[model samples]
Target chain A: MDEGSAALVAAGLGKRYRRGWALRGCAVAVPRGRIAALVGPNGAGKSTLMALATGLLRPTEGTVAVRGKPGFLAQGKPLYQGFTVEEVLHAGRALNPDWDDAYARRLVAEAEVPLGARIRTLSGGQRTRVALAVALGRRPEVLLLDEPLADLDPLARQEVMGALLAEVAEQGTTVLLSSHVIADLDGICDHLLLLSGGRVQLAGDVEELLAEHRLLIGPRELDVPAAAVVERRETGRQSTVLVRGLEPPDDAQAHEPTLEELALGYLRAGRTSGREVAA
Target chain B: MTWVAWRQQRLLTLVSLALVALVGAGMAALWADLSSVLPADPAVLDERYGDLLGYVPFVMLAMPVLLGMFAGAPVFAREFEQGTHVFGLTQSIGRTRWWATKLLVAGLPVTVAMALLGLLNAKALGPLSSILTSRLQTPMFESQGYVLGAYTAVAFALGATAGLVVRSTLGAMAITLAGYVGVLAAVANLGRPHYAGTEYSASGAVEPGAWRVEIGYLDAQGATTTFAGQKCGETPIAQCLLDQGVAGRFARYHPVSQFWEFQGAESGIVVLVVGVLVAVSAWAVRRVH
Candidate 1:
C-alpha cells in the first residue's frame, strides 16, 4: 500500500513487557477513510496495537506511526468519576487544542446525557457515550477505539456504533476499532486486520478477502490444496473445509464464507500453528 | 491542561487550605493573647500556655505529611487507579505538561498556605522561647519558621513521585508517610547540628535561648575530661568533684543567633530534595504505559 494513502501504518512493530513480547513482527496499514476491524482473541495484542498507534505505548522494536492527530477511546472508556458531564467536556476542551466544544456538546445532547450528572452516576452506556464525545471532541483525523463495545448490551452497542458511524461518515475520519467478537464488526467494517499470537494473521479489504475464500462441504475424502486450507472439520463421513484461493471439486457444495466464518477459521488455524511454533 | 488539573485537584486543595486556615486562625488568637501578656513572669506564661506547647508541636509536625498523603499521593495514583491517566495522557497535551500541571495545581496552594501558617506560628511562639526549651530542638524547630514550608514541599514532592512509581493511592500514601518521617528524623539527628559550628564554654554558661548539645567536664588544662570519681556517700557534690580533680564543666551549644542560619541551611537542603523528587516524577510519568 502507498504510505501516503495509509492513515495508520506499522512495520515490524513489537512491544515487550517484563514477562515476554505482547506483540511482535506485526505489520498493518489502515487505509485513509476506512473503518478497519481489528479482530483478535483475548491477549491477541489487539489493545497493544491500538495503544502503539495512538502513541500510548512505545514499541520495543520497529516503527508505528499515525498520520495526523489521533484520538483514542481506551478499554473501559475511562473518565474522571468525580467530574460532571459538563466538566468532562470542559476537560476535553482544555486538553486538546483542536477541540470542537459545540460538536462535543451536541454529541452529548444527542446521547441524552445530562450535563450536570457526575460520571459515576451515569449508566455504563451513558458513560461510554460521554467518553466517545470526549474522544471525538478533538476532531481527530484518526480514531482508535479498543474494545469499545465489550461492556455494552446489544441495544447500546448498536446505538453507540450507529452514533459513531454517523460521525465517521460525516467527518470521513479513519478508524481502527478493536473487538474480540467478529459479529459486532461483520457489516460495519470495510477492512479487516486480524491478529493472533502477537502477529498479523490476515489483513486486507474485507470484501475482496472474503470473496477469495470459500467454505466447502463434502465427503471426508475431499481433495484440496494443503496450502489453501485454512481449517477443516469432520463429522462422520462429512467434511467442512475453509480454503483460500482454491476451486471446489464437483462433488462438494461451495459458497463464499461469512466474515465470522473467515475470522474463526483463521483464529483456530493460528492457535494450532502457534502451539507448533512454540514447540 | 492547567484548568483540567485544577478541576481534578480542586477538592483536595480546598480541604488543605481550609485546614491551614483553621490552624492559622488559632495561631492568630494565641499570638494576640501572648502579645497582651508580654513582660510578665516566666511562670505565669508557662502556666497559661504550657499544655498547648505540649500538643502544638505534634499537630504542626503532622500537617505536612498529612497534606502530602492526602493532596499529593492521589494526584497521580487515583488517576492510575481509575484508569483516567490513559485518558489524560492520550490528549493533545504532552506527558511532561500533564505531570507538571497536576503537581503544581495540587501541591502549590497547600504549600503556600502552610508557609503562611509557619510564619504565623513563629509570631505566636516567639514570646515563649525563654520559658520553653531551646527552639532549635526537634518538634520546636520543625513546627515553626521556614522549615515548615520546606518540609511541606519535600513531603508533597515525595508523595507525588511515589504515586507515579507505585501507581496505587494507599501504597503512595504509606510511602509518603514513611519517607517524610525518615527524612525528618535523618535531617534532625544527623544534619541539623552540623549546619553551623558549635561554641564551647568552660563554665557551662550558655545564652538564654542557646541549644546545649553536650555537657562535659574540663580539667586544669582546659581540655574535656571524663568523670572518674566514685559516688559520694555523705560529702557535698562540689567537694567530691574537687577531690576527684575536676576543674570545671563545659558546654557545647548553638547560640540563639544561629536560628535563622539553621533554618536557611535546612530549608535549602529540603528544597534540593524536592527538586530531585520532581525530576523523578517527570521521568516516571513519561515512562508510564
Candidate 2:
C-alpha cells in the first residue's frame, strides 16, 4: 500500500496490559475515502486500535497515525449524560474549530432527536444518532467508530449506517469502523482488517480479498493442499474448506464464500494458529 | 473550551453558589444582631449569639471541605466514571487546556465566593471575637478570614488531583475529606502559629483573641518554660501558683493584631499548595491516556 494515500496506518503497533498484550505487531493501512471495517472477536483489540488511532490511547510499542484530524465515536457513544442534545452539539462546536453546526443540526433534525432532550433521557437508537451527529459535526478528515451499532436494534442500525453512508457520500471522509460482528459490516465496508487474539489475520480490499479465496466442499477423504487452506472443517462424510490463492484442486467442488464466511474463516484460523501481523 | 467546561460544570457551580448564598444570608442576620450587642460585655455578647457561636464555625469550616468534595473531586472523576473523558480528551482542544479550563471555570467561582464569605465571616465574628472562640485558632481561624477561600482552593486542588489519580468521585471525595482534614489539622495545630513571629509577653494579660502558642513562667535569665500543672496540685490556683515559686509570668502568643499577617501567611501557604496541585494536575493530564 502507498503510505502517502493511506488515511490510517499502523506499523508494528502493540498495546500491552497487565495480563497480556491486547494487540501486538499489527500493521494496517486503509486508503483515504475508503470505509474500512475492523473485525475481531471480543478482546481482539479492536477498541484498543481505535483508541490508539484517535490518540485517546498511547501505544505501548510501534506507531499508529491518522493523516488528518480524527473524529471518534467510542463504544456506548459516550456523551455527557447531563447535557441536552443541543448542549452536546454546542460542546462539539466549542471543541472543534472545524465543527459544522449546520450539518450537525440537519442530522439531528433528520433523526428527529429532540435538541432539548437530555442524553440520559434519549433511547438507545436516538443516542446513537446524536453521537453520530457529534462525530460528524467535527467534519473530520477521518472518522473512527468503535462498535457503533452494538446496542441498536436492526432498523436503528440500518438507519445509523444509512446516515453514516450519507455523510461519507457528501463529505467523502475516510471512515475506519470496528465491530466484532461481521454481518453488521456486510456491504457497507470496502476494506476489511480482521484481527484475532492480538494480531491482524487479514487486511486488504474486500473485493480482492474475497476474490483471492475460495471455499471447497467434498468427501472427507479428499486431499487438500494445506498451504492453500485458510480454514477447514470436516464432519464425517463431508469436508468444507476455505482456501486462499487463485487455483483450486480439481478433485473437489469449489465456490466463492460470502463475506461473513470469509471474515469468520480468517477469525477462526487466526485463533487456532495464533498468527502475528508482521511475521 | 471554556464554554464547554462551564456548561459541564453549570449544575455544580450553581449549587455551590446557592449554598454560599444560604450561609451568607444566615451569617448576615447573625451579624446584624451581634453587631448591636457586641463590646458591651462578653457575657452579653455570648447571651445574644451563644447558640450560633457554639456550632457556626464548625459549619463554616466544613464548607471548604464540602466545596472540595462536591465541586472539585467530581471534576475529573465524573468524566472518567461516566466514560465521557473519551469525548472531551479527543476533541481538537488539547487535553491540558481542557483540564486547566475546567479547573479554573468550575473552581474559581466557588473559591472566590468562599473568600468573600470569609471576609463577611471576619466582619460578623469580629466584635464577638474571643468571647467564645478565638479567631486565631484552629476551627475558627480556618473559618474566619481570607484564608477560608485559600483553604477551599487547597481542598479543591486536593480533590481534583486525587480524582485524576483515583478516577472515582466517591473515592476522591472520601480521600479529599480525610486528607483535607488531616492537612488542616497539621497546619493549624502544628504549623500555622509559627508562621508569624510569636511574641513573649512579660505579663500573661495578652489581648483577647490572641492565640496562645505557649504560656508559662519566664526565668530571670529570660528562658521560657512550661506551666507544669504538677506543681499546682489540686489546691486553689493562687495558692498552687504561690507554692510553685513561679517567677515572672510570660506568654508566647500570636496576637489578634496579627490576624492579617497570619491570614496572609496561611493563605500564601494554601496558595502554594494550589499552585503545586495545578502543576501536578497539568502533568497528570498528559499521562491519562
Candidate 3:
C-alpha cells in the first residue's frame, strides 16, 4: 500500500527491554478503513507494536506513524478504579480535545452501565464497556486494541466487538485489534497481520492470504518442497501439511486453508525458525 | 487536564492540607496561651512548657516526610500500579502536561499550607525560644521558619520523583523516607553551621539566644590553646588555665539575629534539590513506558 492510503505504518520497527529484544525489524501497514486483526501468540510483540504506534513506548529503532489521532484500549482495559462512570467520561473529555461526550454517554447507556457507578464496583463486562466508551469518545482516526476481549465472557466479547464494529463502520475508522484467539477475529477482520517470535510472519488481506495457502493430507512418505511447507504434522500413516504458494501432489488431498489453519501454520513455522536461529 | 489531575489527587491533597491546618490550629492556641503568660520567670516558663517543647519539634520535624510518603509517593506510583498511567499518557494532553498538572495539583496546596503553618509556628514559638534550645538549632530551626515549607517541598518532590523512577508505591515511599531523613540530617549537621561567619567572644560569654558552636582557651599570645588540667593537681581548673599561659576563654557562636539568614540558606539548598527532583521527574515520566 502507498503511504497516503495506509492508516498505520511501521518500517523496521524494533523495541528492546532489559531481558532482550521484544520486537525487531518489523514492517507492515494496515490500509485505510480496514479492520486488521493482529494475531499472535503470547509475547509475540503485539502489545509492543501498539504501544510504539501510540507513542507510549519509544522505538529502539526505525519508525512507526499513525495517520491521525489514535485511540488505544490496552490489554487489561485499565480505567481509574476510583472514578465513577460519569467521571470517567469527564476524564475522557478533559484529556482529549476532540472528545464526544454525548456519544460516549450514549455508548455507556447502550451497554447499560450506570453513570454514577464507580469503576471498581462494575462487573468485568461493564468495565470493558466503559473502557471501550472512553476509547471511542475520542473519535480516533485509528483504533488500536490490545487483547481487548481477553477478560470478557463469550457474550460480552461479541457485544464489545459488535459495538466496536458499528462505530468503526459509521466513522470509517481504521482499527488494528490484537488477540491470540484467532476464532474471535475470524469473520470480523478484513486484514491480517500475524506476528510470532517478534517478527511479522504474515501480513496481507485475509481472503488473499487464505487463498494463497493450502492444507494437504497425504501419506507419511509423501515428498514436498521444503521451501513451500509452512508447517506439517504427522500421524501414524498420514501427514498434514500447510503450504503457501504451492500446488499439491497428485496423490494428496488438498483444499484452501481456514484462517485458523493459516495463522497457526505461520506461527508454528516462525517458532521453529526462531529455535533454529537460537541453535 | 488540570481538572482531571485535580480530581485524581483531590483526596490526598485535602488530607495533607487538613493535617497542616490541624497543626496550625494547635500552634495558634499555644501562641495565645504563651502570650497570656508573657514576662514570666525563665524557671516558671521552663517548668510549664519544657516537656511539651521536647515533643513538639520532633512531631513538626516528622510531618514533612509523612506527607511525602502518604501524599506524594502514590501520585505516580498508584497510576503505574493500576495501569492507569498508560491511559493518562495516551491522551491528547501530552505527557509533560499530565506530569506537571498532577505534580502541581497534588503538591502545591499542602506545601503552601505548611508554609503558612510555619509562619504561625514562628509567631507562637518565638517567645519560648530562650527556654528551649537555640532557634538556630535542630528541631527548632527546622520546625518554625520558611525552612519547614522548603523541607516539605523537597520531600514531596523526592517522593513524586521516586514514584516515577521506581513505579511502585511502597518502594517510592521507602525512598522518600530515607532520602528526606538523609537530606535533613546532612543539612542540619554540615550546612547550618556554615551559613554565616561565627563571631568570637574572648570572655567565653555569648548573648542569651546565640548558638555557641565551639568553646576553647586563649593563650597570652591570643592563640587557641588547651590547658593541662590534670597537671594542675589541686589547683582550680580556671586558675590552672591562666597559669598555663592561657589569657582568657574564647567562644565561637552564631548570634540569634542570624536565624533568618540560616533559614534562607537552608531553604535555598532545599529548594535547589526540589528543582532537581522536578527535572528528574520530567525526565523519568517520559521514559516510563
Candidate 4:
C-alpha cells in the first residue's frame, strides 16, 4: 500500500440483491489526489459501488483497498438525531484518530451550524453541512461521497461544492463523489465512471470520454458512416448521430457535440444496442 | 473521543440522575412520615417498618426494565433508524470498539444513579437492623433489592443488542420489553435449567415430570398464601427463580442476600449472557447492507 500510488483500488466488485445484481463485477482504480465522479442513472449502482469501496458494505465478491483510513459520506447524510450539532462533531473527533478538531470547528462555524442545536432541530441543508464537516474533519487520504449534492438547493449546492473544492485543493485528498446532478461534476471531476444496467457503459478520464465519443448532427439524406455511428436520433429534416472511434468521417458535413450530448449518446447507445465498455 | 461519546449520551445521564433524585426525595419523605407518625413505642414502629422496606425493592425491580428500554434500546437502534450508523461503521473505529464505547458511556450514569441511591438507603436504614430483628420488621428506608443493579446492566446490554438487531427505535423497544418479560417470566415460572436446553440429571437420562416452584405469600394479616407453577414449562428440571411468592419478599432470607447480591454469581452470568448477545449483534450489523 504505497501512500501515493494506491489511494483506492477495487478489483471485480459485485453486489447482488434479491431482485438482481445492483452492481455486477465492477472494477475501478482511483489515483491519489484525483477527483472522480461516478455518474449513472437512478439505479446504475453508483452509490452501491462507492459504499463497497469505502467498506460500509462488504462486497459480495472482490477486493477493495485504501492506502489509509478512508472518509465515507453515505448516499444520504445520516446522523444521530438527538445530538447537538457540537456533539455530532465530537463523534467525528472521537472516532477518527486523525481528526482535525480546528478544521472541523472552522467548517462548522463557517457553515453557521449552531453548536448548541440538536441535529433533529437543524434544517435538511444544515444537517448536510454538518455531515460534510464531520467527514472532512477526518483529514483522510481518500474521501468517498455518495450523492453529495443531491438534495441541496441551488445556492447551498454551490456553497457545499465550493467548500469541497477548496478542501480538495488544499489537502489533495482523492475524492469519489456520485451524482445524477451532472452539472455539479462538470468542473470538479477529472475522472468519470459512467454506468448503466449494472455495468460500466463508459469509464476513463473525462477528457478521453469527450475526445473519443463524438455527437454528430447532419442531414438525414446525407451518407452516415455505419461503423462510426453508435446511436442516432432522427427528427424529420435533421438528424443527431452519436459516433464512437476515430473522427466522425471528415467527409460528412456534421457538427461535433457537447460533453452532455456525448454522455447522452453513450447512454442511448447502451439502451438501443447492448453496447458495453470493454473496461 | 471518549469525551465525545459521553457528551453524546449526556441526555440519558441526566434522565438517570433525575430518576435517582426522585427516588431519593420519595424515600426521604416516606421515612420522615413513617418515623414521625408511628407511635413512640419503638416496638410498634418495628412491627410495621419491614413491609414498608419491602416496597423499596418491589418498586425498584422495574428500574432495569425502564433503563433497558429507554437508554439501551436507543443506543444503536436510533442510529440504524436514522441511518447514522453508516457514519459510525465507516469511521476509524472497529465494530467492536464502537459497541464497547457505547456500553461504557451508557453504563456510567446508570451506575452512578444506582450507587448514589444505594448510599442514601444505607445511611437511612443501617441503624434499624438491630432494632428490627423480625425479618418482616425492616425500615421503610431500606435499600432496594441488589439484583436490580445486576439486572440493569444485563437488561441494558440485552436491549442494546436488540437495538442493533431490530434497527428501529420503536421496534427495538417493543422487542426489548417483550424479551425482558419473556426471560424474566421463564426464569420465574418455567423451572428449566438453561435458556436453550434441558439440564441432564446424573442418571444420564431425560428427567420425567415438569418441576414446580411453590411460592407462599403472607398478606397483611400474617397468614401464608401459596401459588404453584411449572418452572419454565420446559422439561422437568427447576429453572432460575424469577420472583418468590410475595413479589420477592423472601429475598432478604435468600442465600444471595448473605453476600452482596449484586456481586453474586448470577450477576456474573447475566453480564456474560448479555455480552455474548451484544457480540453476535455486532457481527449481524456488519452483514447488514
Reference-based lDDT, each prediction: 0.91, 0.88, 0.91, 0.68
Per-residue lDDT of model 4, residues B1-289, tens digit only: 4675676577887887788689888767766766665444556655756576555655555666788888888888777777877887888888767767877788756855765665555445443443433211211211333434556666777777788887877777787778776655544334212222223232222211222122234433444544355553653323322332322221112211222332244445555666777677767766755
Write the candidate numbers in order of decreasing TM-score: 1, 3, 2, 4
Candidate 2, residue B39: how far the Cα is off, in Å: 3.5
Screening candidate 2 with a backbone cut-off below 3 angstroms (N, C-alpha, C), the clashing residue pairs are: none
Q: Per-prediction fnat values?
A: 0.93, 0.85, 0.75, 0.93
Per residue, candidate 3 scores C-alpha lDDT tens digits across A57-113 of: 999999999997799999899899999999999999999989999999999999999
iRMSD computed for candidate 4:
1.8
DockQ of each: 0.91, 0.82, 0.85, 0.63
Worst 10 residues of 4 chain A by lDDT: A270-279
Model 3 complex DockQ against the native: 0.85
User: Candidate 4 deviates by what RMSD?
Assistant: 9.9
TM-score of chain A of each: 0.97, 0.96, 0.96, 0.90
lDDT of 3: 0.91
Q: How should the candidates be ordered by DockQ, best one leading?
A: 1, 3, 2, 4
lDDT of 1 at A250: 92
B160-268: candidate 3 lDDT, tens digit per residue:
9999999999999999999999999999998999999999898999987689999998888888998777799998877887789988889999998998999899999
True contacts kept of 1: 0.93
Instruction: Provide the lowest-lDDT 10-residue window in model 2 chain A.
Output: A270-279
Give the Cα error of residue A4 in candidate 3, in Å: 3.1
